[model samples]
Target: MAVLQVLTTSVAVALLWVVVESIRRLFFHPISHIPGPRLAALTWWYEFYYDVVLPGKYIFKIQELHLEYGPILRITPDEIHINDVGFLDTVYTGLRDKYEYPLRALRVPGGVGATADAKLHKLRREALVPFFSKRNVLSLQHLVTEKVNQLSEIVASHAKEESQINLSDLFFAFSNEVRGEISGIMKVQSSGTDGKSDRNPTEKEAVYESVLLNESLPPQERTLTRLEQEGALLALAGTESPSLSLSIIFYHLLANPSILDRLRTQLETVPVDASWTQLEKLPYLMAVIEEGNRLSFGVTARIGRRAYEELIFTPSSYANTPGTGTPNTEKSYKIPARTPLSISTLSAHTAESVFPDPFTFDPERWLGESGRERKRFQMAFTKGSRKCLGIELSNAELCLVIAALVRSFEMTLYETDARDVSFEHDYQIAMPKMGSQGVRATVKFRV
Candidate 1:
C-alpha cells in the first residue's frame, strides 16, 4: 500500500507538470514564434537545467541560437533574448519604464542583495554614485598608482626568482585592493605576507561571489547563493558582477597581444598626474576597456518599466538615460502596466547592428568616427537613471590597472598556446570556474 501511494504521488506530480507546460504553451504562443531548441518551446526546464548544471557550455548556446534564429529568441514563457541593438533599445529604454526579472542573491544569512523595489534601487544607486563619481575617482588616482606600483614590484620579484606568477591571482588581488580603497576598506596585501596592514573581513570581498562559492549549503544554513540571489532580487530586482568581464579582459589581451601593445602605448600618453578630466584623450585604452565590457558584460540582465504612460526619444544616451523625457518616455514599447521584462546585456553587446564583427576583439571599432554610431547602440553599462553607478570608477580602475602593469612589466602567457589561456566560465555574474587553466602569466620585469 505504501509503495502504491508513493508511485501514485509521483505520477500525479508528473501529470501536473505536463498540464502546466501545456497551459504555458497555449498562452505563450508569442514565445513559440521565436525559434530555439524544441525543448525550449515545450518547457523552460531544458534551458534551466543547462543554465544551472552546465553554465560553462551555456554561453555558446545563446550564440548558437542567434545564428539559427536571427536576433531574437525566447528563453522562457516571459523572457526574450535579443541580439539586436535596435530591439534592445526599444525594450530596455524604449517603450518600458520598468520590467520584471529574477533578482540575484550572492550571499546568505542576510538578504541584502535581493529586493525588487525600484525606489529602493534608485536610493541605492544614488548612495553609491559618489564612490564612483568622476571627482572621487580622480582623487583616488594616487592610491591606484600606489597599488599598481606595489603590484609591479611583486610581479618583478617573482619573475627574478623564476616563479610563475598567476595573473588570475594577481588581477584578483589588484581589483580587491582597488575595491578596498574605493570603498574605504583596509588594504589587501598581494604578496600574501606582511601582517602590518589589517585587511577587511574575507566576507567583505566581492559580495557577488557569494553565489559562486556558496552553492552547497543546505537551506537551513542560509547559503551565500541564497543571500545574494535574494538580495539582488530586492536591491536591484536584477543581478550582475565584474568577475567574467575582468577574466575575459586578460584572456583577450593574451590572445591578441597587438591589442595589448596598442593599449599600452595609448596609456603611455596619459601623464601619471593627469586627472580624470583628461580621460577623453586616452581613446585607445577606453576602447579596449569598452570592448572588454562588451564581450563579457558583467550584469547580463535588467528590469525596468514594462509599459509606459508616455513616449520619448533620445538615441545619444549611453549611461544615465532618464534624461530622455518623462521618467518612462524614452521607450516606444507603450508597455502595458505591470509587465515583466528582461533584457540580456550579452545579446545586446553582440548585436551585429550595434557592433560590426561583434565576435572580434577590435578596439578600432570604438576609435573611429563610426564610434559615435556604436555609442548610439552601446548598452553594456546600460542607460537610464538606473545605469550602473560604478561605470566611471570601473573604467578608471581598468585604466589604472592595465596601464600600471604594462608600464612596469612585459606580460606574456605561461601557456604555449594562447588558446590554452582559456577558462570555463560559470555564468551567474561572469565568474570563471575557479581552477581551470586560470590566468597564469609570466610578468618579466621591464626595467
Candidate 2:
C-alpha cells in the first residue's frame, strides 16, 4: 500500500509540472508574443519531427510557417527565424554569439565554425586567417592547377575508353587531395586522399605548437581532443561545399549548350591555360558560378546567432512575395537582447523578391547594374564576422576546375536529373535525395 501511494504521488507531480510549464511557455515566456504555431512555441519536439524524424526538413517547414505567421517566427521556444534577405545585416552582425543548441549538432566545439562566443571565435579565426587570405590562396593556385591537370588526365583516359564517370566523386577526391597540399602553406604536412603521411607534420602553426607542447591556451580551448575536432571540421569544410558546387556548375553547363558555348567563347579570350586570376575577369563565368553557388546553397542548415545587444528588423519594402518572407511585413519587429535569431540560406537565396524565378539557373540575373544590387542577398558563404574562411580557396578551385573541364571535354549527363544535384536533404551541407548517384557523366575530348 505504501509503494502504490508513492507511485501515485510521483505521477501526479509529473503531470502538474508539465501543465505549469506549458502554461508558462504559452503565456509567460519573454517571447510568447512572437507569432508561430503554439505547438512550436511550446516544445522542441515540433522541430525534432521536421529536422530529425523527417531528416532535415525543418528549414523547409519553417518557410511554410512564415506564410501563415508573420516575418518573425518564434521557431522554437527559445529561437527566432526571420525569412527576409533585407534583414540579413541585422541578424548576422557585430558581437553576435552563436546559439548553443544548434552548435551542438556540429559537435566541433573547438573548431572556428563551432565556436559560440564571438570573442573566442574571433581569436580562433585570426590564428588561421593568414593561410586563407586572398594573397595566400593566390600563391597556392599552382597546387590547385596541378590537381586539376591530374584530374583532366584521368577524364581523358575515361573518354578514350568511352566510359562514364561520377564527376561528383572525382571532384570530391580532387578537393581532398588539393586541400592536403594547401595545408602545406601553413607548414602542416597532411597526407592526401590516400591517407598516408610520409612525415609527421612539424609544429609550425601557433595553435599546433601550443597544443603539442602543452604551453598555451586555457584547458577548455587547447586540448589534443579539441585539436582533433578542429582537424575534423577542416577536412569537411574543405571538401564538401566545393565539390557540390563544382558538380552543380558542370551539370548546368552540360544541360545548357548555349551557356557552355558562351563560357567557352569567353575562355578563348585568354590563353589555353589562363590562370584563375585571368578567368576571374570573365563576366559570364563569374555569373555562372554565382548561379551554381545559389543552387548548391552552401552550408544548407539554418545556422542561428544571438546578439549581445537588441536588434530591430524592418522588412524591405518588397511587397506581395508569395511563398516568401515579404508576405507579412507591415510592421517592424523589435527583438530583445540575447534572442536567438537567423536568416537561413534557403530563405535568403529563394526570396523571389531578391532573385525572381529563383529556382531557374539564370546567369543573366547576375550580369549588370541590377546584379550589383542583387549581390547583398547572396548568402551562399553567409555574411558577417563569421563568413566562410575558405572562400578564396573554394573560388580558385571552382574557377580552375570548371574552366579546365569545360574547355577540354564534351560531356553528357548519364542517368542524371535535377534531383541528382538539387537540395533534397540537409546533413549540415546539402544532400540530394536517397540513392543519389552524385552527378554522373560520359565524357570525350573536345573537338
Candidate 3:
C-alpha cells in the first residue's frame, strides 16, 4: 500500500507541472515571438491595468508600446496591436469585414448598434443610411442653421454681459440640440435664461441635457400617449450611437488659434448667404474638419469582426503584406469562421508612414488638390461599404456651423493647459472628462 501511494503521488506532481508549464508556454511562448512587455507574456493584466485603471493613458501606453515594439505587439492571448498604416488600411479598410466591435451593449441597448454578423451590419447600415442621405441632411439645413443661430445667440448674450462662459459646455448643448433635431428623437435645450421672452420657442427656451441621456415621464395625458413617450425616451437613451466625434472637432478648433484664423479666412471667402448647398465648394473648410477627425478619433478602444464564414484578408489593393509597406493581392491572415479581430485606431492614425508629422495638426494636407491626392488614405468617416451613413450630413452640418462660426466669432483660447485635455476612453467610446476646460475660448462677434 505504501509503495502504491508513493508512485501515485509522483505521477500527480508530474501532471500538475506539465499543466502549469503548458499555460505559461501557451501565453508567453507563442506571443513571445511577438514584441511587448514580458509581463504581457504572463497575463493580460498588463494591458488591463494601463488601459482601465489609469486615467486618460490608454493611447499613450499603446503609443509607447508600438514605439518600442514596432507596429505589431501582443496585448493579450486574443489581441494583437497593429500600428502600421498599411496594417490599419489592410485590416480596418481592406479587410473591414473581418473585424467586429465586441462592446456594443453598453451604448446602444437592444442590440441596435450591435452587429456581429457582416450581413446584419449591412442590413443595419442600409436601414440607417437613408435617414442620413445627402438629400435628407441637406433638406434639413434650415433646421440646422436655426439651431446654430440659437446656440450662437445664447453664447453671444453671455459675451455681451462680459460674463465668463463655459464654451465647452455650450458645445455639448449645441451638439445635443443638432443631434436631437436631426435624429428626430429628443429635444435638448441648455441655455437657462428664464422670466423673459426674447426669441421664438426654438430660440429662447431651455431643454434639459437629460433628454439625450435619460428618459422622461410625460404628465398624465392618455394611457397610449404616456406609454408611447416612455418607449420612445427609452429607445433614445438605449441607442448606442457615439457622439464624441462632435466634441472632438470642437475641442480641436478651440485649441489651435492659427487653424481658427485660417478657417475664418476661408469662411470669409464663402458668400454671406451661403447654405449647406455651398458646402462642397469650400474644400479647405472640409479639410479642417477632416484633419480634426484625424487628430481626434472617437473610436479607438476595440474593433473586431464576427465571421459569418471562414474569411481571409486578401491583398488586392486593400491589404498590406507583412514586412512590405506595399499592399499585396494575396490573403495574409486566415481568420476562422466566427472569429473576432480587434483593432486600435489611435495607433493607426498616428502611424508616421501614412501621414507625415502624424502628431501635428495640419489641415493643409487634406485641402484643395493636395487633399484630393490623399483621398484614398482618408478614414475619418471610416472606409469600405459599411462606412458611416451620416458622412454627408455630418459634413454639411460641420461646414455650415464652422463656416458660420468663423464668420461670427473671433475666438481666443482662455486656458493654455486646455490643449492637453486628453481622452477618457474605454472599449468603444471616448470623451473629455466632465468640466474639462479644453475649449475655453471667448467668442467675440466679428463685425
Q: What's model 2's lDDT at 172? A: 92
Better of 1 and 2 by TM-score: 2
Query: The CA-based lDDT of model 2 is what?
Result: 0.82
Best-matching candidate per TM-score: 2
> Would you give me the overall lDDT of model 3?
0.54
Q: List the residue pairs that clash in candidate 3.
A: 99-304, 99-305, 100-304, 100-305, 107-240, 108-240, 189-207, 315-328, 315-329
Give candidate 2's TM-score: 0.91
Candidate 1 off by > 4 Å: 1-17, 27-38, 94-101, 104-114, 177-247, 250-257, 272-276, 301-305, 308-339, 416-426, 431-435
Q: Kindly provide the TM-score of model 3 when superposed on the true structure, using C-alpha atoms.
A: 0.70
TM-score, per-candidate, Cα-based: 0.69, 0.91, 0.70
* Number of clashes recorded per candidate: 39, 0, 9
Each candidate: RMSD: 9.6, 4.3, 8.9
The C-alpha lDDT values of all candidates are 0.54, 0.82, 0.54
Clashing pairs in 2: none
Mark the 10 consecutive residues where model 3 has the least summed lDDT: 204-213
**Model 2, 1-447: lDDT tens per residue?**
999999999999999999999999999887887889999999999999998998889889988888778577899998899877768887886789988898898888888899999999987777677667887777667778999999999999999987899999999998884333334323432322332244234312333433433433566765556767776787788888889999998888888899999999999899988898999999998899999888889888878888878777776755335654345556777788988988888888888887888888988899999987888888888898999988888889999998898888999999999898888787888788889998999998888
Q: lDDT at 252 for candidate 2?
A: 87
